[model samples]
Target: MSRPEPLQPVYQFSSAQEPVSLRQGTVEVDFNNDRFCGMADLVLRFLPGPRLVFHAIVRSTSEPELPFFLNVPDNLSVSFNGQKMEGFRGRWKANGNTLEFDWIPRSQPVVLSDMQPKNSVAAIFHLFNFPEFRGGNYQEVAPLGCALLVLESEDWKISLQELPEDATREAWDQIKNEGGCFLTHMVKMERKDGEQFSGEDAQEQCFLLDNFLSFINGGRCWPVCGVGLDASGETTWETFASPRPVRPPYSWFNPYKASQAELLFPLFAKRWQQSAEWRDCLHSAIYWYVQANTSGGSPSIDAAIILAQAALERLAHHYLVVDQKVVSGKGRASDRLRMLFSACGIPNEIMDATPDIRRANGTFKKDTRWMDAPHAITDIRNSLVHPVSKKKLHDCHVDAWKLSLWYLELSVLALCGYDGTYVSRLTAKYVTDSANVPWGKKA
Candidate 1:
């Protein structure tokens, strides 16, 4: 009988997995755990406007890595976080060496669902590579999501298939149903309990929460990943992104609370973390400004303001100084303050037409009573930085705080490539500059 033909074993989706179930069903998946398969990456189907499909790229981990092959039946249907996440996608191919996915929510316009972005914040790539793309820094952009995404941390490529020009939007919309948006999974960072949060590089975390708060006020809430600092500055602590799922506010006007909300200090807490728009100098500068503006106890007035001044100093020395390599100069920090402020933002068409600020040109058809906060905060900032503690001094603590904040906010706007009413409105909200001349260059 030919030696009974030696028997060979084959793998299956599961030794005993289920057929299919939209609700919930027991499916015993007996796959190799050491193979790196997990519930988070479980490829499932969700039935929506008919049936939304999700295709997972499966691969094996053994030495001779094999493509993970599972015979998924056509009738296979499943539900995950929810049906709204029907377009929610993810991938962990390349033997777990690579990870990324895009999620296009069920919303017609394809917005991100209510899940705090992790490892990195979520954003639309439509901004780049579009007829609408007007160039500058920032990709030239001011991404509203986590800045870590663009760094060399991962190799991202646009493998999108070619499409007819007219079908661009329609084609992308189609890709979402196949799990495009859910490609990149935002993982969390954890540290030992005693570990102190890095104070200098929490720019992304701070701005994310700040923007979240601002968005919520407008009735569109978005969750933010955050970090916390220990008052004692001692503890081997483990911290993760704000695990709190975003929901409606108990008090919309005042939603951000330290004790109540899920606020966390960022793990990417270094001056090195930067977005395309804000360089290292700007990143550190903005972070310092956030530290000073934090709630609960007032920010260290002297320290915060001083750091703010130093940030501007660095900005001028590194970014604006005509001598690109020179770090020092003859003038004091204050003497160079005006020069930096002069180069704060470019004179764009929209800024010219703004109501009460000096015009870069005749862009402003008319003028109103709008005067900018004086750009000469250098003296006050210097006073705080180089203090004469012995002498009982007088300075508008509130004004100094406001001044530093205004300076930082203006710099942020410039980086974002935003100007006009968008920035003007933010100025009113951020620094109470309601004069509509927030971008007004006061040299």
Candidate 2:
């Protein structure tokens, strides 16, 4: 395992990789063919951070004497390398003769073709911001339904089985720490003895794998693009963009290791198999969890705390009333949550373990108020939602937010039946080592 090259979030499939540059093109600047128009020597660069940069030298085409600025249209058509590209919704500015445009894609994922099936397909994709393995070698990480998932080396290359002599802690850091994409993994689905792999099955399984990885890594871990090869030798290219925010740099919450993939992913696969309803419930849960913890632009902590709490309540409802039939769903929120944690074998003293949260609770606790984790959390949440002129929001708002997220993460992992080691965000300031999950045998 030599030091891996840093990956840019943007790259072309061809030889001209990140910051893919194209020269010599034109822009259509008028609505009518014979009306006002402009041509430009265009340059487009697909830069890292998944950004697009457009630069052009403009000149009037319909009226040669007209100023270039006058000829430039508010909405222009783009063409580069003899190909017209659509969806260039960006702001354009002119500085003398040069016109420039820079744009970032929207946050939502854009899947070109909905789950079209392909029988017994092999899918190869590059992972974004994924961590390196301990051995720094090619490994089959997990299985998704009938599909086998393998984690390969960077740029679709397979590494030697043995770890490189120079492998170090620094080598295992995620690629997004710098920027760019690397580490191509594969999903191979084969037909069972007499069964046929449906056309859309491969894509469906890949996205399912994506959600699970994103949840475990506590960030946006998605395949930017991939190629699919069917058993019949038919090849197709799959392109999609999920431009969600990655994990916060300071977040210490359960940095999922490649080693846990085998143990955890199978459990997730089993959960997904339950029913469509179960899948929907899990997806909703993951969405809220990601929003609470990983949204960009300095998301509101008050809103995030509320989101985490709402997710925990939803999971508790599904697990207790809908799935397990353990509770009648008639109780105080904190009591219900206590029952939920008890059922999951999570310790109730998590607040005590996190010194920041504990100290925050002490600062505002009145007499016997906020005696424990659940009470403290709910009380803080109430303060945020139902404000009082005399009641000041806790200065430890971030601590409470993280505590709720910790609870939510544990609950979700337990729901998936995971019994692996996890780094506790609660006591991470003092204790940085990974520990067995609360319900795991060692714990």
Candidate 3:
């Protein structure tokens, strides 16, 4: 597919004072003359996650040097084709006259040089496998730091817009057929405040949004590339980032169909402003959940089950003791999980559970009767971790994993105080099917 035009001519690599056009994911970025090494041609490739990779072969003197170092002075000041670039880390290996280099940014978000302060900031982010909105090419989602604009409390706003559809269709189609990443969604952020906004600030805001978007998308929503704009709407920062290499599964909220974006996002922003523990717990839960679902490697089904159980226990502790303050931090895992589910308005029975899971649980009997979700989930997890407990059927273990994941999803949505519709793995007839949250007023 022909590469769609970028938001602007933001990437400016040059050689011999001539502009270099980026094509087919590769470009030659020239190096500046330095004490240890002379100017060399550095081949750069932009991977699917907008990950940057650099390779170069250069001659070095006998003077031993670190594996890699920035070619720029003090590792801060840099310019490519007259466009300012922030400092980034580089790694290399020396093999006589053939020195190989790999460049990856070390938490140093790229900030373009600006002549003067700007009152507002705008940022554009490219998303992988994000669903497009139905019936329209544009949708205004939510703001950061606040719920309502009437209160003038929000610091930034977010919107979803379509890219060049025809130009990008072939690339997206390839991704759908073969396993790869493509620019599937375009996300825009605009600061509402009048104060001067910097690239550093934009990075922080984007990080917060990334976490929220991941939870909503039920997968990693790392930006393939990001472009920051000043008040006058001029480019101020740009960076290609490494995103998790995984295709998204069925997400809870399908922005293309029905979602709780308007309600859920604001609650997240509010919690971000008022609570620190909330932030930590959510991040941990998201990390564990993703790890459980990630494929590949050895017999990871057991490990995945353990991760899901661990997340449930952590969230249960947080919801019962930390946030709600209704119970002490001491209790059986099953009891705590039950309490957490009750507080979230999630049912205790396995009846409402997905048919396969409910059927699998029925096959296992404890005390002459089948256990409920909390008991069955915790029991199976116990069998895995402890030698005294009876081993569960392999099918039961898999179903328990699914049941635990369902509980985890509902608990999070309830914690956010969301009442809007969501796609449920238990009931959805298709990928885009959705229903109201069980605990929500609308339900």
Candidate 4:
């Protein structure tokens, strides 16, 4: 019988030596660089085509003496199962005191049926745990000719070798007693035809297969399992079932809004309801019309004028709401505003009036250089809702969009006889206090 050839070597560093021993089929390499500690593992598999995977990790012990130094090879070459991999490259990155290199093979379906079980399985496990070497230590024992023993504290333990026809019951009991956590890495070799070795014997069992080998090789824990349990303490392996859904807490009233509105509305309502700046601008243009239509100097006329002006100013603010939109296209701000006005009982003629009428009766303006806040707001809103124009938006310009939202909110409060200043204060408080909230998942 012809012996199976050893798997090919795919990675080697210029300043490193191969490991003194292998735990699984993997080989570790130690480099001479003071700035880095590195290792490599080799993985071999038979069925899905003969294959090899190599992984390495480099750690930085201290800052580099020179900004540019060659601690790693310029290029890497890998050969697997008699096939040469072209352009095989390794990647390295420095993270604080450590660097990592991942070298992937260029070819596919590299089989490993003929390789000896001890070397093949060991290499596969080493490749799987390549990612966790820095924070963890690996322990391995190689038996004379049959099996290899490997373990990592707080991680896992594994044994790889061909099983005997009569594996001792004591051996099985000892392994099971050792926490039933150790995984068996195995492969069976059989011939192709009748009177020849039947390959079916080599097929792996699903449960016996370590589903976490890839992650373990990558130096990470296995992902959460998806098994479900029933009340009887037995595994409830069902195809489909509805999960219990959680509902958010509900209340008859929104306490946060109620308390906030009550605390702020009365204090600033008058300023919002009747701003001197808005009244002065509108009174000059509409005073005569109001007097002619109603009794001059009547309090009712003044109140009516104020309500009408407040409504218009609120509408003007609404016309300028801006936000980031992923897709680009012309925004229908004008059409939407017209529809809103019609719904609010405002006539089309009033909606279509000249800027002067808007400025005099509402807070809109035509030509003024002193920062037309409403127009600036409208431009931002259009930019967000419409297609990105040739114009580039800066950080300050984005801030303007937020300001427009705040001001619009205030305008709404004012129209509703609530204090607008309270909205500003509450917004500032919420934003400041929210900074302490944790934002992302822990490692």
Task: Give the Cα lDDT of each candidate.
Answer: 0.32, 0.55, 0.59, 0.29
The candidates, ranked best first by TM-score, are 3, 2, 1, 4
TM-score per candidate, chains pooled = 0.33, 0.67, 0.75, 0.19
Which parts of model 1 have CA positions greater than 4 angstroms off? 1-240, 243-278, 295-298, 322-330, 345-376, 389-393, 422-443
* Clash totals for all candidate models: 34, 9, 0, 25
Tens digit per residue, CA lDDT, model 4, 105-200: 554322323321211111221111011111111112222222322222121222223222222233344334532211122322112221221111
Best-performing candidate as measured by lDDT? 3
Instruction: Write the residue-wise lDDT of candidate 1 on 198-247 in tens digits.
Output: 42222333344334232212222222222222443222221111111112
Off by over 4 Å in 3: 1-35, 39-50, 56-100, 104-120, 135-153, 193-195, 294-299, 352-370
Error of 1 at 108 (Å): 34
TM-score of 2: 0.67
RMSD to the hidden true structure, all candidates: 21.5, 7.4, 7.7, 27.3
Minimal lDDT window, size 10, model 1? 6-15
Put down candidate 2 lDDT per residue, 25-61, tens digits, no spaces. Answer: 4554333243322443322233444543444444334
